[model samples]
Target: MKTVPIQIALPEDEYADQLAFLKKWDDGPKPPGWELTPKAVVVFICGGSGLRLENNQRMDIAPKFIGDRSLVERCVVTLAGARGLLLVGEPGTAKSMLSELLSAAICGTSALTVQGSAGTTEDQLRYGWNYGMLLAEGPSEKALVPSPVLSAMRAGKVARIEEITRCQPEIQDSLVPVLSERRIAVPELGDYSVPAREGFCVIATANLRDRGVSEMSAALKRRFNFEHVDPIADKKAEVALVKSRTQRAIADAQALIDVDDAVVDTLVTIFKDLRSGITEEGWSVAKPTTVMSTAEAVAISTSISLAAAYFPDSGAQLALIPGHILGAVRKDDEKDTERIIAYFDKAIQRRANANPNSPWAILWDNRHGIS
Candidate 1:
């Protein structure tokens, strides 16, 4: 039997070629322990058009994050200066994805990461001990187990802390000394300490929705430069991104049907309207409690596309839009189901009335999916 490949690849592995290309593409001075110059790193995330090598080979860098280039630049600048960078944003706005891309481009790997949660202990962010080794040989260097942050300090690479606010306040505060002093003191080793290498820095992400869950102390907040990531504001750009990503997802799944662009456009419009509580036509709509982010839109599009591919005779792809929207909206709150139905009764129904033959009409007709 043929072996199955992994479903998802890390940023470092997925963008290995692009990272290598950027490294050779720019020979400019880079900060200590950085693989790419700050300029190249920005381009790697924001993308560049018409880039060429000495051989005149055209290599266009694809845009990974669909947000402000300025924000990405600020992040690079912070890391370049050896300061911690905190990216705070609404859920599903690709904050964690941006962190991974930056780490992969700066170093050669994005695996040095600590996922923050309520159960996260200080040892996960600092260091732990190997009980076996500790018991057998007493507290020694060999008995010490370094966390991802410690590993990054030793390797002079970027380390990521995802959902930093999800961790307990006290546990989160453990990073204060590490970020400020740039060293992890090991009392077990008798005054020994692991100083952060020249390139070592941190990139942490926190969701605005998680504010009350585990608020960071003022001292911890002061240690990092905060950047607020917002949702994509341009409709055309978001639609294009959703279509591109959905098509790519279908291709990755080896699906047989082509993605319906009209379906994707309609789906994204609904998401934007629900997300912003306002329609493109200047109509007011009740926003769902759940985040109707572009990432969610892409997932719904991919699901609808794959459904069409697998069940070709079920119905037209456009007909699947309302059901998927209902599914996406009903995730966080049960009342959101009523909100979605009202949206269908208002914005979608109006669109259907405006043009009875358009995709909106199909969505309006299938509005019963919400109920």
Candidate 2:
């Protein structure tokens, strides 16, 4: 039987070449158990100009995270100092992606991860036991099953906690001792404890919108250096990111359609207007309750492209924008539908009237899709 490739590849596996090249490119001093120096790690995330290596070969490091270089530096510094790094941001601001890239760059792998959720338990953060082995061998090492955090501690690598706010407060507090003392006490085994190796640290992400679900305790909060990951502020940058991601997504689907830059620009404009509750022309618009993030823009762009690819007779790609926008906005609140309709009535209608040749005109023509 032929083995199939995974739909999504981990950062470590997907960027193995870049990692290896960085290791050889920068031989500067690295912190304990770190794969790349702090400078190289920053370059890996924020990107750098082409570098001429000692071997006369040129390599260009692509920017993975489109945000502040200083922010990435702070994240690296926090990890180097052996403190927990907490990334807080809106839902689609790429906080989790930043965490993965940081872990992959610092350690050799980004597989040590704990997905936080309402159903998450302390055992998933600390450790668990193999019931069959526990029944036979009692609380011996053979019976103990290490969690991702424990595995990272034992291996001297970085561990990631995704959506930490989604986890119960008590369950989230299980890391207090681990972060402060850098060790986990195994009460089941007398006098046995797992001490975090040199370079063992944690990176956690929490959505700002999920604050009320489970707030971190003061002790836990104090142990981590919080960094806010904001949305891409530059219009050109956001459009480029959306187009790049959309092309990648379309390629993943094995589709041959070319992504229309004009269509993507129009899509991103609508998202930005709806997200910020203001148009580029300084007109105020009603905002949707749901987040209109760059990630969602990419998704809608990819959907438009794929729809055009799979169904040639589905009209122009620009015509699909309004319906996709409606689908994206109406997720959380039903009132968002009225807000989107108002946006179409005011902003989109004005743009369509101003330029009949523009993509916005097509979106305006298809505005009925929202209703």
lDDT of each: 0.90, 0.92
Tens digits of per-residue lDDT, candidate 1, 1-371, equal: 99989888998898888888888889999999999999999998999989888888778887999888999999999999888999998988899889999999999888999999889999999999999989999999888999999999999999899999999999999899899999999987989999999889999999998754236799998998999999999889899899999988998999988879898789888888888899999999999899988899999999999998998898989988877887787887899988988888999899999999999989888877778
* Per-model TM-score on C-alpha atoms: 0.97, 0.98
Q: Model 2: runs farther than 4 Å from truth?
A: none
TM-score of 2: 0.98
Best by TM-score: 2
- Candidate 2 per-residue C-alpha lDDT over 196-234 given as tens digits, one digit per residue, 9 for 90 to 100: 998899999999898642368888899999999999989
Indicate the residue-level lDDT of 188 in model 2: 97
lDDT of 1: 0.90
Model 2 RMSD vs true structure: 1.0
